[model samples]
Target: MDSYYFDEKSKFDARDPLGILYKITFRLIQIKVIKMALIFTFFVHLIMNCLHFFEILSTFDADLLVKYGPTLFPLVYGLATIIFDLMFEKKTAIVLEETFSQMWSLDSTGSKTAKKIKKESKILIGLVVIDTILATVAIMFYLPIMEWDIDIYYAIRLFEMKFSPTMSLVFSILYYATIPVLFFSMLCTTFALFYIMSYEKFQTYAINDLLKNISIDYQKIDDWKMMRDQSYQNTMYKRLTICIQRHQLLKRMEVNINQIIFTPI
Candidate 1:
C-alpha cells in the first residue's frame, strides 16, 4: 500500500473532527452501557410476564406480552451482533477503515472527486444522525403517549405490586428511565447498520467508477496505437498493468466486505 493512502493529513484521519466523531459514535454503540440497558429492558418485560404467569401481578395480559416481547428480540439481537463485531472483529474493522481512507485519498490533492465523496459521506452521516434523533423522540415521547391512550400498561403490569410510596416512586422512575435507554441503544445500533451498508454500497460504486475509468484509458491507448511509438506503447502497458492491479484490489475489497461485514450483518 502507498504511504499516501494512510497519510495522517488525509481527511479520513481519525484525528480530524468528523473522524473523531465517527470513532466516538462507533465506540458508544459497542460499549457495555448499551448492552446492559437492553438487558434491563428485556428483564423488565420478562419479569412482567413471569409475574402474570405466577399470578403475582393482576391485570397483566399474557397475549399483549407475547405480541410486544418478540418484537424487541430483533433490536436486542442486532445490537448484540454489532457489539460483538466491534469487539471481536478488530482486523476486519481495520481493513474497513483503511479502505475508507484509501477511497478518500483517491485522485490528486484536493481533487473534485475526493471532495464529492467527502460531501456525500457527510450528508449520509447527517441523515443517520437525524434519523437517530427522530427515532429517539418518537420512542421516548410519542409511543409512550400512544400506549397510555390505549392503556397497554395494564397489559405489562410493571407497577402492579402495592409498595411503600418511596419504593413505588423508585420503581416508577427506573421503569420510565429504562424505556429511553433501551430505545436509544436500539436506534443507534440500527443507524450504525444502515451507515455500514451505505458505505459498502458507496465503495462498490467507487470501484465500478474506477473500472470504467480504466476501460476509458484502455480505449485511449488503442487510439494512441495509430501513432505507433514504442515508448508510448511501453507506458500504455504499464498503465494497463496498474489498472489490472486496481481491478484485483477492488475484487479483494468486495470479497472482504462481503465476508467481514455483510455476511455478519
Candidate 2:
C-alpha cells in the first residue's frame, strides 16, 4: 500500500515478476481452504519422496545413490521446503508475501528499470525452465526406465490397486508428477532466494541516495527558523525515517533468511 511497490502505481496496475507465483502466494495467505489444500498436497508429495528415499536405501546400492543423488535431493529439498512452509505457515506466509511485495522492481512501466526487470524475470524463468527440461530429458533418456519409480509397486501393493500395464504406467506418471510440482514450488520459495538477495543491493543503493539527498536538501535551507526551512526539514525528516525503517526491515528479512532458508528443512 505504501510507495514501495511500483506495481500498485504502474499503468498495468501490476506487472509482477513471476506473476503466477505471486498470485498463488498472495492467495494462499487470503484463503484458508486453499492453504489447507496446499498443505495436504505438499504433505502427500513429501510422503512419496520419503518412500522413494526408502526404496533407494532398500537397494543398498552405492552406485545407485551416486547415480540418483542429484535428482533425488532436489526433490527432497523442494518438498521439504514446502512441507516446512506448512509447518511454519504463518511465518512462511509473512516472508513470502513480503518478498513478493518488496523484492519486485519499484520502477513503473516503460522505464529502463522496468525493461531491466522484464529481462531479469525472463532470465530467472529461463533458468527454471532449462533445469526442468534437462531433468526431464535425463529421466526420459538417461535414467533407466526400470529405475524411475515413485515407488509405484509399493503403492499398488498397499492400496490393492488394480493392476494392468496401462494402469501401472499411469500410476507411475501420477506419483512422479511430484518432480515438476516440487520444482515449481522450489522456484516460488526456496530457489528464488538468490533473486531476493540481489534486490538487497538495490535497497542499499536506495539508502545511499536517500541519505545523500537529505544531506543536500538540509544544507540548501538558508534559515532554519523560517517557515520554508522548517518545511524542508520536515521533508528530510520523513525521508530519514523511511531510510531507517527500510534498513531495519532488511535486517529482519536477513535473519529470517538465515533461519528459515540457510538452515534447511
Candidate 3:
C-alpha cells in the first residue's frame, strides 16, 4: 500500500466541527449502534415470536398462524441478513475506512483532480448522513402504523390466553417495545450496508481516475527523460514503477472489497 493511502489521521479529519461530528456520528450509527440494535432486537423478536408461536400451538389455531406467518417472514429474513452482515462488519469497516482515508489524502497533492475527488467524497458522506436520517424517519413513521394496525391485532389474540393480569401487561409492554426496535434495526442495517458499498464504489472510481493521471505523468516523465542524465532517468523510472505498483494495489483493494463487503449484501 502507498503510505499516502495508509495515513490514519486523514480518515476522519474535517475542517469544521460539524464535519467532525458527522464523521463520529456516522461511525457510531453504522458500526456500533446498528450492531447493538440488531443483536438486541433479534433476541427480543425471537422471544416475542416464540411466545406467539406457543400461543398458536396451544390454541391449535392453524388459521392464526397462517395469518401472522406471512407478515413475520420478511422480518425474519431481514434480521437474518443483518446478522450475516454483522459477522463480516469488522473487515468491511477496515476496508471502508482505508478507502475513505485515501480519498482525503488524494487531495494532499494539491492537484485539481485531487480536489475534485475530495469534493465528491464530502458529497458522498453528506448523502450517507441524509440516508440515515431518512431511514430513521421512515421507520419511526411506519412502525407505529404497523403496530397499531397489525401487531395490536395479534397481541389482542395472544392476550386472550389464560394468564395473570400482571404477566399479560408485561407481555404487552415487551411486545410493543421489541417490535419497533426490530423494525428500526433492520432499516438501519440496510442503509448502513448501502452507504458502505456506495463509498467503496466511489473510491474505486476515484482511484481509477488517479491511476490514469499517474499513467499520463509517467508518459510525460518518459518523454522528458531522454534528454536528462542517466541518474535522473533512473529516478524517474523508479517513480514510474511506484505509480504502477500503486495502481495494482488499488485494483486488488477493489476486488477484496467486492468479495468481503459486497458479497454479503
Candidate 4:
C-alpha cells in the first residue's frame, strides 16, 4: 500500500503512490518556475503545431483533417486539464491526505481486512504499471522506430524558413525529445483519473470489510438477553454509528474530489 505522512513543514507527502507521479503533478506546483516551465514547454509546442498546421491548413483535404484533428484536440484538452489540476493541486493534496489519515485510523479493526486491502493495492499499482508501459509504447509511433516517424512531419514546417532535408531531420529529433514530456503532459490526465478512481475502489473495499465484520460480530452474540441490556444496546449503537460515519466521510470525499477534478459526482 502507498503511504503518506504529514510533515511539520509540508501539508502531506506521498511515499511514491504512483512513482513520482504525485511529485511531478502536485509537488511541482510549489515550485513556480518548474511548473511554469512545464506549461511554457507545452505552449511552445502548441504554438509550433498551430503555425505548422495553418501553413498547410488551406490545402488540407479530408485525409489531412482526419489525420490531424485527433492529435490536435487531445493536446489542447490535456494541457487545459493539467493547468486546471495545478490550479487546485493544494486542495487536492489536502483532501487526499485527510482521506488517507481517516482510513488508516481504522486500520486496527481487522487483520483480515488489512490483508485484503494490501492485495487490492498490488492490483491497482500493477494497473498503473501497465498504463505507463502502454503510454511508453505509444511513443514508438512518434519517435523514429520506423523510417517515417509522424513527428518528423510535425516538426517539418515549424519555422518560416524552408528546412533542408538534413535540417528537417534535426528538427524532428528535437521534436522527438519534446514528445516524452508532452506525452507525459497527456498522461498526467490519465494519472489523475487513476488516482481518483482508485480512491473510490479502496473506499468500497474498506467499507465492505467493516460492514462484514460488523455482521459477523453481531451474529456471534450467543445471548439474546444481552440485546435487551442497556450496555449492549449502547455498544451496538456505537458500532452502527461508526458504520454510518464511515459512509458519510467517503461520500463527502467523493463529492469533493469530483468537484476538484470536474468529474460528475
Q: Relative to the true structure, how large is the alpha-carbon lDDT of every model?
A: 0.52, 0.53, 0.55, 0.60
Runs in model 2 lying further than 4 Å from the true structure: 1-21, 24-71, 88-90, 96-105, 108-170, 215-234, 262-265
Task: Superpose all Cα atoms of candidate 1 onto the true structure and report the RMSD in Å to 1 decimal.
Answer: 6.4
Q: After superposition on all CA atoms, what RMSD does each candidate show versus the true structure?
A: 6.4, 6.8, 5.9, 5.8
Query: Of the candidates shown, which would achieve the greatest TM-score relative to the real structure?
Result: 4
Off by over 4 Å in 1: 1-21, 30-95, 98-112, 142-150, 154-156, 162-165, 212-265
- Residue 167 displacement in candidate 1 (angstroms): 2.9
Q: lDDT per residue, candidate 1, 69-138, as tens digits?
A: 5443543454454454444345545666666554433432223444555777778778767876777776
Structural similarity to truth (TM-score) of each candidate: 0.59, 0.57, 0.61, 0.71
Candidate 3 per-residue lDDT, tens place, 123-190, comes to 76677668668767755653435534354346544654655778866766665565566655455456
| Candidate 1 lDDT score relative to the true structure | 0.52
The reply for model 4, stretches above 4 Å from the true place, is 1-34, 52-67, 105-109, 144-152, 160-174, 215-223, 263-265
Worst lDDT 10-window in candidate 4: 3-12
Off by over 4 Å in 3: 1-26, 29-37, 49-66, 95-104, 109-111, 122-126, 141-165, 215-236, 254-265
Clashing pairs in 3: none
lDDT of 2 by residue, 126-154 (tens): 87678667656654542226663433234
Clash counts per candidate, in order, are 0, 0, 0, 0
Show the colliding residue pairs in model 4.
Answer: none
Candidate 3 minimal-lDDT segment of 10 residues: 1-10
